[model samples]
Target: MTIHLSKSRLKYLSRLGLFLFLLILSGLFYASCNTQSSRNQSGKAHLGESPMTDSMVVDQLIQRSRSFYEETGMRAEPFDRFLQEAMEIASRHNLLWQQVRILNTIGRRYRDRSAYGEALRYHNRALTIAQNINNKGLLSEVYNQIGVVFRRTDDNAIALDMHFKALRLAEETRDSFNISVAINSIGNVNANLGRYHSAIEYFLRALEYADRLDNTLGKAINNHNIGECRLKMGYPEEALEYFQKSLAYNNQIGSRAGQSICYNSIGAVYIAKDDPVTALEYLERALNINDRLGDLMQVSISHSKIGEVYLLLGDFAKADDHLNKSYELAKNIGSRFQAEESLRLLSRLHEANHNYATSLEYFKTATAYRDSILNEKNINHLTTMEAMLETEAQRNRIYQLNQMTSEQLITLGRQRLMLTIIIIIFVILAVITTLLIYQHRLRIKYNNLKNQHKLLRSQMNPHFIFNALSAIQVYVLEHDVEKSTKFLTDFAKLMRLVLKTSHHDFIPLKDESEILKYYLELQKLRFVSPFNYQITIDEGLDQENTFVPPMLTQPFVENAVEHGVRLMENQGHLDIRFKKLNTQMVVEVEDNGIGISSSIDQKQKSGINKKHESMAIKITKERLDVIRNDIGGKVSLEIIDKKNINPFDRGTLIRIILPIVSQNN
Candidate 1:
C-alpha cells in the first residue's frame, strides 16, 4: 500500500476510484427510482385490476350509491358499505380527489341518519384532504356539505359561516353548480332562523344561478324553498303559486320526492285558505306518493296535514286516525319536530271532540317535545361554538407556520374588525325595521277601532226615533187610550231592543229576528195605510248558533216600510226571508209597493228632504265594510226593481248577504 508509483499511474488510479464512486451513486439512484415506481404501481393495482378499470369501477359505485340514496333515504348500512369500499379504493390508489368525494358521501350518509358527530368527523377529513390538495373546487363542495350537516343539526351560525365560505370558494373557482348549492343552503338556514325575506333573497339568487346552469333539480328546490318562506310569512296565495311552479319542474325532472314536497306545500296553502276539502285532496295525493316512495318523514308530514284537514271538516274519527298515524310514523322515524306537530294536532283534535283530559295530556307531551327542541338547539349552539374554537386554533397554528409579514397580519385583523362592525350595523338596522313595522301595524289597528266606534254610533238613526215619537204624539192627542197603550208598549220594546243590540257588535240570528219582528209591528201600528208582512226562516239555519252584525237588516227594512210601502196606493205587502247558503246568510226584503226609483222621484217632486235616508244607506254600507274586515268574509247588498221587469209589478226587492259566524270565532 505504501509502494511508490509514477505520476501517470497515480492519476489513473484516482480517476478509477472517482469512476467507481460515481457508478455506486448512479446504481443507488436507479434502485430508489425503481422501488418508488413499484410502490406506486402496486397501490394503483390494489384499487382495481388495472388503472383504466379502476376509474370506471369507482365511478359506477358512486353513481349506484347515489341513486340508491336518492330513491330511498339514508339506508345507512348499504350506503356505508358502498362509501367504505370507495374510500378504500381511493386510499389504496392515493387518489386525493377521489378520497374527498368518498369522505363527503360518508358525511352525507351520517348526516341523513342524524349522526352529527360522525358527519362532522368525515366532513372534517374531506376538508383536510381538499386543503392538502389545494383544490378550490373540492374545498367548496366540502364546505357546502359541512354547512348542510350543520344546518340539519340546527347550528345555524356555523352553517351560515360554512355556506359563506363555500360561496366564496365557489365564486373564486367559478363553480356555478357549487355556488347555487351554497346559496340554496344559506337560504335554508335563514328560513330555519325565521328570516323569511333574507331567505327569499338568497333563494332568488340561487334560482337565477340554477336557471343559468339549466339545473332542473336546483331550480325545483329553490322554488320550493321560496314557497316555504312565503308560506311562513303568511302569503299563502303567493306561496301556492311558487309551489305550483315547483311541482311542474319536479314533474318535468321526474323527481318523486320533490313532487311530494310540492304537493304537501300546496296542500298547506289550501289549508291556510280554509279550503279543507281541496287541501285534503292535495294532501292525500302527497301521502300516496310518499307511501309509494317509502319516505317515512314525508309520510308523517302528510298524515299530520291530512289530520288537520279532517279536523277542519269536523270528521273527528278520521282526524284521530290520521293524527295517531302521524305520531307513530314521526316517532318511528325519530323526527322530533314532526312528532311535536302531530302531538299538537292531536291535542287540538281531542279538544274539538270535548275530551279535555285527553287533550291536556297531549298538550303536555307537545310542550315537552317543544322543550326538547329548545334543548337540542342549545346543544347545537354549544357544538357550533366548540367547532368555531377548534377552527380558530387551527387558524392560529396555520398563521404561525405562514411566512406572512406583520403588515399583512395587521391588515387581516383590520378587515375582520370591519366585517364585525358591518354585521353589527346590519343587525341593528334589521331590529329598527322590525320595530317600525310593528308600530305601523299598531297604528292601523287603532284607526280601525276608532272607525268601528264611529260607525256604531252612526248606525243609531235619529230620524226613525223622531218619526215614531211624532206618531205616538198623534195617538196621544186622539185620546185613544187602549190603542195608544198598545202602540206605546210595542214602541218601547222596539226602542229597548235597538238600544241593547247597538251596544254589541254581533247578535244571535234569533235575537236579531225578534228585534226585526218588534220593529215591523211598531211600523205597522204607526202607519195609517193597511200593510201586511210575512217573515220566513230557512229550516237549515241554526239561528242560535249563527251570528251577524247588529242592525244589518234594519236600515233596508226601514227604507222598504217608509219609502216603498208608505207611497203605495193599494194594500202594501212586505216579505222578509232569512236563508242559509253554505257559509253565508241571505236576507231578502221584498215590498209590493213603490220601487226605489219611484220613491226618489216622488220625494223630488214633493220637495221632501230624503238626505237622512241616503245617509243611513251610506252608513249601512260602511258598517258592512267594517264587519267584513273583522269577520274575514263578504257582506254585500243588491237591489232589484220589480218595475224594471214588469210595469204592473211596482215594488223593490233588497237582498243582504252576510257571512254566518260562530260566537267563538
Candidate 2:
C-alpha cells in the first residue's frame, strides 16, 4: 500500500480525484432543478409563458390589487389600473385562483357602478373558470356575485334562483361566509318583490348564520335589511329598534356606509311618526356621512328625505332647495328611482303653491321616469328568460350527445316521452295555480269594496243628521229671522255637499275643508258656551288637487267639540291644522278642554252610554285600513293626551294622517 510511484502516476491520481469532485457537483445541480420543476407543477404555474419563479411576484401583485379594492372606496381610475396589472400578472403566470379572484373583484366593481352587463360578463367568465377548476368555494362566490347583478337589473326571479344555487353549493361545501352572503341576497330579492314578511324571515336566518360565524359585517347587513323590511310593512317602531341595533353593530365595525344607511332609516321612521323636527337631525347626519363617503346615490336619498321633512314642517323654501339638489344629484348619478321620487315631490310642492301649469309638467315628467323604470325591469326579465331557455336547449343537446348506443337511444326516446308528459303536467298545475290566485285576488277586492260601503254608512250616521236638524229648529223657534235664514241656508248646503260626496269614495281636500268650516260654524251657533275655533291650512298643501276620503276628519272634529270642548269649565279653543306630509294629508285637531280621561270619567259617573263615540272611531280606523289596502299608502291616527306631555295642559290632540287617494283611480 505504501509502494513508491513515478511522478507521472501521482499526477494522474490527483486528476482522477478532481474529476470525481466535479461529477458530484453536477449531480447535485440536476437534483435541485428536478425539485424546482416538481414545485412548479404542484403550484399550477407551469402552463403559461412565465416561469414558476415569477409566481411570487404575480401573487404579490394580486395581493396589492385586492388590498386596493378593499381599502379604497372603489376609486375607479386607480382600481382599474391595478386590476388590469394584476390580471396580466395572473394570466402570465397562469394563476387560476388569482385570476378568478381578480375577475370577481372587477365584476363587483362594475356592479357597484351599475354597469350590469359588464358585471355579468366578468362574473360569468369567472364562473366558467371556477367550474373548469372544480372549485366549489369559488363557484359559490361567483354565483352569489352573479345573483347580485341580476338583482340590480331587476330580474328578481333569476336573482333568487342564482342565490338558491349558491346557497346549495355553499352548504354542500360547508362554506359559512358564502352561505351568509347568499341568504342575505335572497332576502334582498324578496324585499324587492314586495314580500316583506318573507324578506324579514330570510334576513333573520342570515343573521343567525352570521352570529354563529361571528361575522360582524354580515350581522350588520342582515339587521339593516330586516329594518328595511319592517319599514316597508309600516312597522316603524320595530324598524327603529332594528335600525338602532344595526347602527350599533356598524359603529363597532366602523362601517361608514352601514352607519349612513342606519341613520337614514332612523330618520324615515321619525318622518313616519310625524316628528319632522327630530327627523331632520338624523337625516342631516346621514347626509353628512354619505357626502364624506362620496356615495352619490345615498346622498341623493338623504337629500330627498331631508326635503320631505322640511315639507312636513311647512318650510317650502327649504324643501324646494333640498329636493332640487336631490334631483340634480340623482340625475347626475343616473339614479332613476331617486330622480322620480324627487320629481314627484316637486310636483306636489308646485301644486301646493297653486302653480298648476308647472305642477302638471313635473307630474308628467315623474310619470315618464316611472314608466322607464318599469320598462327597464321588463327588458331585464325578458333577457334572463331568454338566457334560461338557451341553457335548457344546451342541456337537451348534451343529453342527446350522451346517448350514442342503441339502448341509450331507446332510453333517450323514453326520456323524451317522459319529459313531454312532465311538461303537460306542469302546464296544468300552473294553470290551476293561476286560476286560484286570480280567484283569491277577486275575493279580496270584493271584501274591500264591501267594507268601504260599510264605512260610508257609518260616516253618515242618522244621529248626526238629527243633531243638525235640532240645532236649526231651535233657531227657527227663536223667531230670529236673520239667524234662522242663515241656519237654513247653511244646512241646505251641508246636505247637498254630503249627498254629493257620499256617492263617491273621495273628495278634494278643499271641498272637505269647506264642509268642516260650515259644520263648525253651525256647531258654534248651537253651543251654550262660546268657544274659539281656527282652521289653518299649511302653505305647502295642494288643497284643490289632493283628494282624501270624504267625512274622514269630521267625526274626530265632532268628537273634539262635543265631548272635549263642551266639558271644559272655561271658554274652549279648537285648532285644526291641515298639512301635506309625503303622500299623506295630515290633519291635527286640538282642543283646549277637559281631557279625554276626565270626560270619560264624568260620563261613567253619570252612567251615560257612549257607544256611538267608540263606534265612530272604530269605523274610522276600519276605513283607514281599507284605504291603505286599496291604494298602497299608509293611513294612521294618533291621539295624544296632552296631560302626558304637560300635567297642566288639559285637552286631547287628534292627529289623523289620510293617504292622498288618487283621483284617477
TM-score of every model versus the real structure: 0.52, 0.51
Over 4 Å off, model 1: 1-50, 68-75, 380-665
Candidate models: Cα lDDT each = 0.81, 0.79
What RMSD value applies to candidate 1?
45.9
Best by lDDT: 1
**Model 1, 93-173: lDDT tens per residue?**
666777788888877877776666667777887887688567899999999998888888777887999999999999998
**Which residue pairs does candidate 2 place in steric collision?**
none
lDDT tens readout by residue for model 2, 414-492: 9875875686566555655655565566557655655665456435557666877787788778878798788778877
Candidate 2 lands at a TM-score of 0.51
